[model samples]
Target: MSTESSAATTLTTADLTLVRALQREPRATWTRVGAVVGTDATTAARRWERLHKAGLAWLTAYVTPPTWTVGYVDLACTPDRLLAVGEEVCRWPPVFSVERTTSDHQLFLGIAARCYHAMDTLVTKRLGVIPGVRSVRMAVATHIHREGGGWTVGPDQHEPSRTSLPLPQFWQDGSVRTIVDALGTDGRLSSAELARRCGVGESVVRRVLARLLRNGELAFRCDLAHVAAGWPVIAGYRLDVPADVLDRVAAAVAALPETRLSAAVVGRGNLVVSTWLRNPADTTGYEARLLRTAPGVRVLDRAVTLTMPKRMGRLLDQAGRAVGYQQILPAGGHPVPGG
Candidate 1:
């Protein structure tokens, strides 16, 4: 599979099968993936290389430290500079996802920081001062019910076992950082490749990888372009639920098949969820279904995403396919005033 030819490849059913299997076990061996998807190991490896080189499908890793805080920042930009501002903001390490949506705020951002103070500095001092940014409305997540790492675009396969891993006291090891940085752009890199990059033996790389996963310090997610996967619409909704039932409401909403992100945020509209829909019309149906799931929920605002320039540090094309990568370092790792 040559890189030039791989760039033009179109997805087929076989590709989806491969993707579905990988979604369940991101670092599964080619032999295991081939068995699950009904292909030979060599063929599975070849197909995956094509998909990966084209940026149509890939795996990436993220680290979620216990003290990290997540927030959403809505930026109303000058009408003409929407894309320009988004291009700049999306490159920032702290802003994980940037969406151009059909709301007063033209650009929507998902961000994280080591603490509230870092968050404040990023929003008030950095983002707010961007040349075209007119206003900024920011809300910190009170509790995250689910994140995009758990969402799957294809049919369910057997799920991976997910026992809660114990948090290690010394999770700030240099080897862990090395693994995460390497995996952020290529989560399926071979142990030998990782060992070479980290300047460690293959055995040490394998050991660090196992310990990171076992300690819940690292996560690998299989991501693809939603439009290319058949979900063409990204819908955002804000809801007001009674403070007493916020947790229950968030959990129920997060369970919906279409949900990509669901979190309880700090604002009058306390619950926010982003969903992937087949089309714009499905928005109404999804809303009705959620209302039934949590009757006390009141709709505050809703917007259909026009374009998502970046998702979790991956630059995306207008069609939503991955085009490039940006390393999203953990909160404190990113410098202030820059993100």
Candidate 2:
């Protein structure tokens, strides 16, 4: 088994490079990656085997944000209630992402839906009814930067900053079949995995990824569920409003406190809101606080999400644990000095 990268594990220079590449493009092929870091595919693959088994790096997929399909909220509570509340939050379909972080004051939520009424049901009827829930905070997604290309941390960054220019935009086409397949297994997959999945040489996978990197075609991985580790108080709410005023009203909803996410959807009764509360008893003036901020005088409808169906971002379970390669540090993994 490989070592774990924790506060205690020591990192090597090679390990740092691997980690850095993942930071650049979690999906880059090992073959391509080696080319950038001055090694062959086998060498890179060997290095990765150790790093992963050691728990130095992990690759995962995050449900992209800036979605217009859902609503969101935050909850606050004691650390002791996190697991209980998290289990409850994972029961609803609209609740996409649930986290236990954010100023230690709120439990973050990511909501999704086709309309507003469905969101309302999640916040008021389902969530609010929960015995432990205190209040719900709500918001809507107006603009988003889904895990599209551009966040990939590449080799040494010796290459010029690609951030200054517009990221290349391309829809997922069959050309990326190799790349995507690799990512399906490990967002932090080395080039060897990509080659094996695409039935190509490691070099080919590497080349393709380099191109994808410049084009901004890959999605960055994220683990939003980690926040649920902290205990929190969660709640859901809604606003009563006519359809015409949605744009103005929705904006108001996004700014509410303890709100981690929001969305507009069909069946979401009125305007839905989700918020985090430190305590259930602190839900004072929830209506006036949220609805009043909306641009129009609208009736609020809501239901607390008692049971969330699924949450965003699952940790990689298929990652290898047995180490086969020489022990070494991971790429892009070196710690920066001074905090």
Candidate 3:
């Protein structure tokens, strides 16, 4: 484990290099990463281990259910039960993210479930029953133009490989679910280790992984604590964009330096965007520049995230350091009970 003093230090150039390498290849071998980053395999592995221990960096896998629907929900909560409600909602199996924001709605949730019926049940039956619940407004996502997996902390040292591979038609089998579960917490697991966990051969594991990556059925995200990374302010926005230029507007927003997430959903505010700002006051300037770049884009509502208790399955401290992880498996995929 890294000492508190060492963990408190700012990230070094070598640390950034290693993180960039992992961003390109989330599951690459240490030897391969070392070759690219100009270091020995042992040093590369040790540096990554340190980063993970400090809660500054981590890798997580996301599998999109084939027949599932995705939704972004806003909940209005009574002031007294806000904290309790947020904590409980984060434990739901289908919920991927939960945030406390400064807006009319106190909480924001991202959910994924098997189908429309499943999503309805989750919102109406499960989430609605929570004690502090007031009102729920959900926006079903139509297309995900950009996700956090594509966001990077630094520029790439080398161009990523563009090699194309054949994709599988069906990936909802038990073996695939096993692989996803094993890799969810640790995306750097070796093929042999994954095979052992899945009770399959190494070659079979490799094949399934390749298909998942090629077909866009899975996304691997390299997460960092924003405040620790020197970017303290996290802001979210919903944009009302012209229908014809929606895709163009989303692309422009994703290209911004501060963008952490950008997507198009079905709601009054169709485009949802999240950005990290160097300072809280920079929000106005950033929004101004966005309007200049995308002429017809109108900002509907903006909220600054006051506290994020959980993100991408990892529970975070007040200072944004990862303290532990909570595994939320897909409800309809495989029944791995949450701990």
Candidate 4:
């Protein structure tokens, strides 16, 4: 398996199996993976390194939403000073993800301290103070649901119709192992391919999938990459408003055009709103409008992003598995299905 070079790199079927197995139980030992994939432990470890180096896969521990304050900022830099500005923003202590998008604005952000104060401190004390920061629009995370990214696309598999939706752990019993893994990476897999991956016949897979859909173990028609619809404001905002209207304000902003991911997360202000503007020029006006839309609103902080080093809910790494340069670039729609 190769993660370093997407081109001229190849992965074995066993590597594919290993990828699926680890996604389920991050702690699955090499001995365990070897047994399931029919390889020795040493080979498994070496293969793990190969996968890591090639950037094909990663084993990660996620930051549960409760603990970290997720902030989004859109920053407009001097066109000539853009690269220097990106370098400076990337230096901020709290930023875990930074990336330059198609827009002139750079996306700079991170998952940080839970106290809303920390967000203000970062904005006023850290990010806002950066050279050429211009102005920023900030948003805090309230509740986050990063949709299952793995969905296969091809002849045999059609997106499985989960009859009943089940809890995340519903598959702890193994009735839908393949189904879950497939949807986890790519949510639009065909039933025929799903049955092949799960080692079951197509008919059985369909029946079980229908039940899972009905139970809620599976979600239908959820595309977290809301930017897919193609509007680009990258609106990030922070506001101090009555706590009671928190939900309503967030909902209203979310209802606007080009809302990809929105949250009422922890931050200095009571609410942090994330949305796309479709026009960076409208950035300030957009924030002012949010304040106007809701009564008694005060703008506390804001910044536009320069770059998104990591997006959605990607795991950066942990103590042992956290390799510095290793990143599982979300698949740009690969064959087996996975985010």
Query: Each model's C-alpha lDDT?
Result: 0.79, 0.47, 0.75, 0.49
Instruction: Name the regions of candidate 1 deviating beyond 4 angstroms.
Output: 1-10, 65-67, 155-169, 334-339
Top candidate (lDDT): 1
lDDT tens digits by residue: candidate 1, 202-225: 998888888877777677778877
List the candidates ranked by lDDT, beginning with the highest: 1, 3, 4, 2
What TM-score would every model get versus the actual structure?
0.91, 0.45, 0.88, 0.46
Model 4 Cα RMSD, 1 decimal: 13.9
**What shift in Å separates residue 11 of candidate 2 from its native position after superposition?**
4.8
What ranges in model 2 sit over 4 Å off?
1-6, 10-13, 23-27, 61-72, 78-80, 90-96, 102-104, 145-185, 188-312, 315-339
TM-score of 1: 0.91
lDDT of each residue in 207-315, candidate 3, tens digit only? 9888878777676767777676766788999899999998888877777777777778997599988888889999998898778767878888899998777776777
Query: Per-residue lDDT for 330 in model 1?
Result: 39
lDDT of 3 at 103: 80
Candidate with maximal TM-score: 1
**Model 2 lDDT per residue over 213-246, tens place:** 5554334541211112121344565455567876
Query: How big is the RMSD of model 3?
Result: 3.8
Clashing pairs in 1: none
